[model samples]
Target chain A: MGGGKRRRKLNAERSGRIAALPSAAPAEEPQAVTVADAAPDAPKPVPRSPYEGLPARAFWRSGVTEQHPLRVADLYRKKFALSPSHQIATAGSCFAQHIARRLKGAGYSIVDREPAPLGFDAADAQLYGYGLYSARYGNIYTARQLLQLAREAFREFEPAVPVWRKGERFFDALRPSVEPEGLASAEEVTAHRAAHLKHVRGMLKQADVIIFTFGLTETWEHRASGTVYPTAPGTIAGRYDPAVFAFRNLTHSEVLADFLAFRKRVREVNPTVKFLLTVSPVPLTATASGEHVLPATIYSKSVLRGVAGELYHRFDDVDYFPSYEMVAGHPSRGFFYEPNMRAVANAGVDVVMRAFFEAHGIEAAPRAAAEPRPKGDREGGGRRKGGGKRSKDDVVCEEMLLEAFAK
Target chain B: MRLCFIGNSHIVMVKSAWDEFAKSHADLEGEFFAASGSKMNGLELRGRSLVSDNPSVVDQLKATSGGRTSIDVDRYDGFVLVGLNLGLVNVLRVGQDHRTVATVGKAPFGHLCSDGAFDLAVKRQFDAASSRRIAEMIRSVDQKVPIAAVPTPHASRGITGRSNQFWADAELLSARAEQPWREQLEDFIRACGVAFVEQREETLDGRYFTERRFSVGSVRLRGMTERVEEEFRHMNADYGALVLQDVMPHFGSAA
Candidate 1:
């Protein structure tokens, strides 16, 4: 709380100083009547370039070009440190699952309102989308989706079609993957969603820190109700009808406004909650926009990254974690990606988490013991040399189905 | 009807009780195939026989089943799988950190989980039990023979004075919460094509603890000697007789 207020004051002072400076460049002609003419006896200020005295991290040559990707230090600095006791709630794209998993493994007080019950297979629980977030709302790819979820959870708004029927089973349109097999009937879906929302509401009201990873800008929404779905209707469940469901690529202002609204709604019940935002580094599986996939991904990521930067500068409580830059920035030279060049490698996640933990002054929990390796592969342990087979693409990305339609 | 009782150490009670039942009913015949705790897990379906490669399990099979190291399962009219860790205690352990709608008011410290999720979790736990695995193995070899699973009995009521942290943690459980776990277990076993023979209702003190008389003087599997008074999980011959009574009806004319 104090951090945001302090940063705002510093920013105001900096702006005032900038405003007091000379607005235009001086003429090349020799000025006989200089500062010396007005104050002949006064001391003259020394000439210096605007970039003088800036830290090494400010320059590309020293910050990235000359340094090893893994050794590029000071990539992240916490605006406010997280206490061991803080109740941290996490939600976002599939990439955010890495953050939630790491936070949980590191012994942070990660708030899990709707945890998978005991004795369930850990892998099956993950498949069912439990323990993947603070609540089992599946992926919150767009800010609009996040805002819609908060509204729905708090009973302020209801989606036009809450249940999507696929064959004989019904799925909660908001989070189709959370119940992978779907429910027996629409009534069952409604009951599950009601139970889920109660926990989501509690998670939002009580959390001290909420970390969100902005994933995608392209979303499918109900034309009438403006309800943004996590994935396209037909991707997970429900038939994709052009008239009923409209595809929209969100602009910068819309993403910012959606997050702002989400923050405001949560703060209404929890005034002290802080937000940690990041941009998911994994590229979009397929873009609905007419542009090429590469350019579309850049546009989506750029919008999210810009929003995070603006939010960081505007609010002290809204810190930005550069997981995006750590994994996908030029310094890494695409080294952290798998062979497919989309899913992040295990090593990439390690580098991001190392920086995150170091910034918070916390020691990261050691990784779980690796299984016994084959004779020739014992050297690298977890991640092999280069982005080899060990870069497990384990995340559940429903958007990947769009790629199946490519051919 | 000739019956084959397959299980771990918990089968001792049922085996001794079956001997008593056979005296009055000359038409009924039964044989027990047992091993130490979890050694029954080593029993594999080899062709038409259920056999074990582990020498200790092989020795146990011989000692318990009248020198027969392998069972020709088709010879038996029905099979009862006894205690391979499917029971109320394991279900109660899950309540340490999660409560369903049935348990929310009773459990003050756990997260409130949905009843459906909690039931699925309980079903998975029961499904994972070695008893269910053995039942499935039997059914795979013989699809038509009647098969039933008898879960381990509830702890003795004498546990009230104990300082075991596990039992203390289970204090959050009530009969209402336990009902779902029971129903889930039965449903899961039935789904696996095995009948679930529940613990005798009269033998239970509460829903999850057996009456002390049924648990007292329980015998060990290695010998027919009585277990020490501190034993809380093993059931005595009287308790086993009730279990047999529950299992018989599932085999139709066997009752």
Candidate 2:
């Protein structure tokens, strides 16, 4: 009789606890929910809106207001907080440089494992793609490029087509613009890439955060070997051969698959690393999809943004920063871009950085007045005195080569 | 002590500074043998003297050494090669990409190592080539003569003006090179069996660039007044005296 009475008491307690909780649990909540027991008849269970009490990003977001102008409010609600010592390693498409520069300026520790030689000036250093990323990998504009780089850096995954030759000069097929003038021989390029991989490995092992800005879905690659390149062949160094190389417009599924594979590989090496993802706000400089460049840019960014968003939901450590929506999205209009309507202006960078800091609870950073143009602007134009034809003051975008084919 | 100076347009400052330096050290006398362009590289060792290879080249050595066609290399107590391409950009070009501030995330440098091994190798190779040429010529004339190499000076910020917008990436390097680039250059020149005159530590701003007050004038440049109005790399007599000061200790010592 006493054992039966105790079972009855337990059932009563469970019902009381369920009755105390608010109508429903969050549909998309990750982790466990807390429950408490109360004395009596509580409110009946009812379905609650998933959007209720959701973060600002779950709703319509706008940073641009009549008063704030270029600035945005509630743009980034960070899932993680970065301290001054966070080892941030940045590498991605041409636009990614702006993010890296701002973080470094704000005094957050950027993981620069491979520093250039002493006495080099800013212009010459960048010409050789020195300060752009963790290991000098030039404008990694595609998901395939990012996945291959991670694989090449850590695993034994070597591209079957290792080197590309233009005239007598040899270039690393993966990242043709990195050497600027190109290497003397295939052996030199391999040796150089080996050393670069070491730095990349170091970056992977140590970085607390790796912000990858996906730039393009359009890619040209080795059809047989399934190798992807930073830029199309011939624009910078290699010759374009249809028989050997094939143009691929990656769909949403392909990008998502690659990112998942990248994340899995990354976990094998760097288990604790948190990933911050952003789709490049800059438009495509050229399109091989036989479509207008405008629609091509849209299609590319959309696929990338979609994959990145899904990845955010799929992985706990992966967070989406929405730099794409902040700059290219309709809320801010197109005020952040330069006259070229492609290059993101400093004010756009200013607001992006502001949101990043605000969301992460990092104090506002002081103005970096000594900066010339946006770091992304260096992706195209100009020349280095001692090096190749690269923008000495601005960014050097390989996509700018498309402008050459115009008219 | 008598000195013979060998240089390009950079020789003008040392020539101009001799008197002011002489006020403190009256024992020094110097002579110049220089011309513009590739002609400066044509200095040849004829017996124990240097002579002009080009007939069109001006031969100031002829006047300095009585009526001889060339000045006796052994006659001079010291030799200085001023204003060759000592510009930091020259060192920067030898595979040292010092820009650290940039966007996005890190990527692999194509056929290039970001570990600095590739860049350091390039720098070493360039230094070797330059050292080989200088060592061969200097040892040919006389191993005993104290020779110094002063590279191109960096452009002054005063002339360039303070900029806020363009140089966020330069923080990758110290105002001066953290690695002893001067010492490395000195070691290279010394391995060449010659002395290297180091730039003064105090005269530099953070970027390893020279100050504007020393930015006097260059004979090589077309439009230079007595006062330097821009961020010119060449130095004047006052600056020349500073270089000479670094040169003094080596000269009095046996070569």
Best by DockQ: 1
C-alpha lDDT of candidate 2 relative to the true structure: 0.66
Compared to the true structure, candidate 1 yields what TM-score? 0.68
lDDT by residue (tens digit), candidate 2, B14-100: 766766877778677766665543354555667776566666444533433334556576777877776644434344333334222
lDDT of 1 by residue, A73-94 (tens): 7668899889879999988875
Measured against the true two-chain complex, the DockQ scores of the candidates, in the order shown, are 0.27, 0.09
Candidate 1 DockQ category?
acceptable
- How many steric overlaps does candidate 1 have? 1
* Top-TM-score structure, candidate number: 1
The local lDDT score (0 to 100) that residue B35 gets in candidate 1 is 87
| Chain A TM-score for predicted structure 1 | 0.83
Question: What is every candidate's alpha-carbon RMSD to the true fold?
Answer: 12.2, 18.1
